[model samples]
Target: MLARLATLCPAPILQRVDRLIEPLRATCSTKVKAGSVKQEFEKQDELKRSAMRAVAALLPIPEVGKSPIMANFTSQIRSNPELAGLFKRIKKDSASAPSTDSVELS
Candidate 1:
C-alpha cells in the first residue's frame, strides 16, 4: 500500500513520504541484537531493500526535476555496494516488465 501511495502522490507529498520511509534503514539496524541469528539480520536487510526499490521508482532516471530528499536517498543507494546491486536489479527487472498505470491489488 505504501508503494501504491507513492505512485499516486505528487512531488511534495512524495517528499513527505520519502522522509517517512528513509528511517526504515536505521530502525532495521538498531532493532537487531548482538546475539541475533543471521536469518533475522537478512530479514531486516530484505525489508530495507524493498523500501528502497519503492522509493527509487519515484525518482526520475535522468533526474531532471528530482527532489532533494529523493536525490539524497539516491546518493545513499549509489554509495552502498549491496544496496546498489539490489537497486540495479530492480531497474533491470522493471525494464523487462510490462508497463501499466493501473495497480493489481491482488
Candidate 2:
C-alpha cells in the first residue's frame, strides 16, 4: 500500500516547487516606486552636450549641418540670400555633416 501511495503522490516535483517559491517570496514582499525616468534621460543628455564644450572652439565640429555648423550656416545664409554659397558648402560637407539631403531629396 505504501509503495502504491508513493507512486500516486510525487515528492520530487513538490520539493522543486518550494525551491521556485523561495526566491519569489523576496520579490513579492518588496514594492518599488517608479519615478521620473525622463528627468534621468534629460540629465544624461545635458551631460553629453556640456562634455563637448571641454574641447576648444578650433575643433570645427568635424562635419556640418549640426548645431555647430547650422549656427555658422544660418549666419552665412542670412548675410547672403543667393544660397549658392550655402549649397556649395552643403555639398562639400554633407558626407560628414548631418542631413543636407533635404534639398536633394526634394
Candidate 3:
C-alpha cells in the first residue's frame, strides 16, 4: 500500500515523504513493534484531511461575483491605506503640469 501510494503521489511531495515516514517505519512496520503505529495512523489521517480540503477548494462556486459582493470587496479595499496611496499616485501623475512636448502641434 505504501509503495503504491508513493508511486501515485506527486514528486515534490514524495521527495520529503521518506524523511517523514522513514524514522517511524520500524514501529509502523507490521513486522515490528506497534509503538510508532499511532504516529503513522495520525500521519495518514492528516494526509487524507489535507487532500479532502484541497479537493474542496477546487470545487466551483456559483454567483461567485455578484455585484453586491464585488462592491463590498471594492469598498473594503478602497478603504485601505495602500489603495489610498495608489490613488494619490495616479491622481498626481494625471494632474502633473503639461510639458512643452505635450502641446506639440499636429
Candidate 4:
C-alpha cells in the first residue's frame, strides 16, 4: 500500500506523508539498532539477517519512476558502509537459499 501510494501520489502529498511518517520511520531504525545489539550479545546470525530484511522492506524501493526523495533515501542507505555490507550479505544469502514458494505440480 505504501509503495503504491508513494508511486502514484502527487509530490506535494507525498512530501506531507513523508513528513508525517518520519518519526515512525525513525522508530523502525531504532528497532533495527536494538536487534543488532541483541544479535551481538546472543551471537545470532538469523537475527541480523532478519533485521536486514526488515530494513530493506521498510525502505522505499530504489527503482526508476519512484519519488526522488525515496531514491535519495535509498542511496543514503547504500552509501553507509555498515548498511551496505549487511545488504550485500542479505543478497548473497538470498541467492544461495532455495525458494520456499515453489510448488510441485500434481
Evaluate all candidate structures by whole-model CA lDDT and list the values in order.
0.56, 0.34, 0.35, 0.45
User: What digit string (tens of lDDT, one per residue) describes model 3 on residues 1-106?
Assistant: 3323333553543344334333333322223236768777677645533332221221112222233433343344346554334434433453443211211011
Q: What is the lDDT of residue 68 in candidate 3?
A: 45
Off by over 4 Å in 3: 1-36, 61-106
Q: What is the lDDT of candidate 2?
A: 0.34
- Runs of candidate 1 exceeding 4 Å displacement: 25-34, 60-65, 98-106
Which runs in model 4 stand beyond 4 Å of their true positions? 1-51, 54-65, 97-106
Candidate 3: residue pairs that collide: none
Kindly report which residue stretches of model 2 are placed more than 4 angstroms away from their true locations once superposed. 1-36, 56-106
lDDT of 1 at 80: 72
RMSD of 4: 9.8
**Top candidate (lDDT):** 1
Model 3 residue 36 lDDT score: 63
- Tens digit of per-residue lDDT, candidate 1, span 1-106: 4545545755555546446545744642345677999998888777876765565545432331255655555566677776777766666677665442232111
What C-alpha lDDT does candidate 4 achieve relative to the native structure? 0.45
Best by TM-score: 1
Error of 1 at 82 (Å): 1.2
- Count of backbone clashes for each model? 0, 0, 0, 0
Choose 1 or 4, whichever is better by TM-score: 1
How well does model 3 score by local distance difference test?
A: 0.35
Worst 10 residues of 2 by lDDT: 51-60
Which pairs clash (backbone N, Cα, C closer than 3 Å) in model 2?
Answer: none
Each prediction's TM-score against the native? 0.62, 0.21, 0.25, 0.40
